[model samples]
Target: MTEVRSTPTQRVAPEEPPPSDPVAAAWTDYLAAARQLDGVRRGAATAAGEQARSVQAAREELTVVRARLAAQQSRLRERGVPAMALVPSPPEVTVAARSMAAGPAAVLTALRTARECADAADGVLDARGWVAVVGVWRASRPEGWPDRLRNLLVYGPLAVLGPVLQVVLVLTGSGARIALAVLLGLVLPAVAFAVGWVGVGRFFRPGPDGRLDRTPRFGVLVCGVPAALCTAGILVAVLTG
Candidate 1:
């Protein structure tokens, strides 16, 4: 009862500690700022590297595309296309530039697409060239001429050389010359066949690296038949005359 009427105890909240040193707080803030700045610098470096790589790749692709286009232009010119026709128009160039306005990445993509198109064009040109050559070959030869017949044409002239020489020697009325012609007939046909074989391989080849059916056995037959017949005929004439 002594304190029954005493005043209620006053409640006091605990005081917070004094503020930290100003220099330490400032140093902490400075560290955070430095870390942020370092992060920014790293991000900038990464972006710059990627951009540089894209630019370099675009340049390489452009070089390749230019070389391909130049070669194609030369080929087209040889095929009678005008140089002006091969050049890109101003509108096309403007459109291409607009397409790559976004960045070097876009430029690289455009160049790669152009390279693929150029490769396809090269394929088409090669096909057309092959067709043109084949057309010429077919037009020059007889209709429906097979490989054998075509090759025989090459060997025909060479095969007849021995017989022609024999005929000339017989006309000269020299027995020794006729005998020499007979000896030549044996050796000359082989030589002619060799020459014709090389000629056919060179002339009838389809492309720069293409091979054709040389038909060696057939060529031998074509070359030998004329010489054999001519030699037999000459022998008969010599014995009878």
Candidate 2:
């Protein structure tokens, strides 16, 4: 009978970790710090979702590979091969095993990773949902009474003033009525146009893309509609009288 003695094991070089993306790491760290400080999230929904999916996919893949490794080990043992030689397991498998053992007992070897994946998904989903809900609520909220009143002060009186003054002057039956009408017709429109130009421009201050919005919405709301209504009212009063 020949006795075989175990030889001293050769030191295997450690597996180097996968190279990391520096800019991505920096941004991720920054985002984590921001989140810890309760700051607003950037790229909330889409980015978080992708991260969760990546983790889940990794966990699933690892689970499948580890299961295959176990079956392969069993097959080697049944075939009278030296199964115990490679029994120590790979570094990735070791780390995963430690985490799994340290955690609650589970049927699957990748349960620890799966739980981590679930947690990551939950946190991101909650944050994204909360941000969306707040955004929608803010959008749907009506303008405050104070702002509306302030705007009315700026626009309402201007609309009524011209019509009232013209009506009063026309009712006086003075020979100057014709000249007054001509002056009002030209001057009032010019005033409305000037007011519209200034109001609309100012309303667009610090506008998007550093470009001023010259849209007629504000101008029409503040000046055009009022001027039209007042002019119509004045015309009606003059003709009826």
Please report, in order, the local distance difference test score of every candidate based on alpha carbons: 0.85, 0.59
lDDT of 2 by residue, 96-176 (tens): 667666332332436545556655655765686699889888555432223344344445555556556666676777748
Regions more than 4 Å wrong, model 2: 1-157, 217-241
The C-alpha stretches of model 1 lying farther than 4 A from their native spots are: 1-4, 140-241
Q: For candidate 1, lDDT tens digit of each residue in 1-241?
A: 4656668899999999998999999999999999999999999999999999999999999999999999999899998998899988999999999999999999999999999999999999999989999989877763335678878778888888868887787779889887877777688788888988898877675533555766788878777777777778778888999
Give Cα distance to truth, residue 99, candidate 1, Å: 1.3
Q: Total backbone clashes of model 1? A: 0
TM-score of each: 0.59, 0.29
Model 2's TM-score against the true structure: 0.29
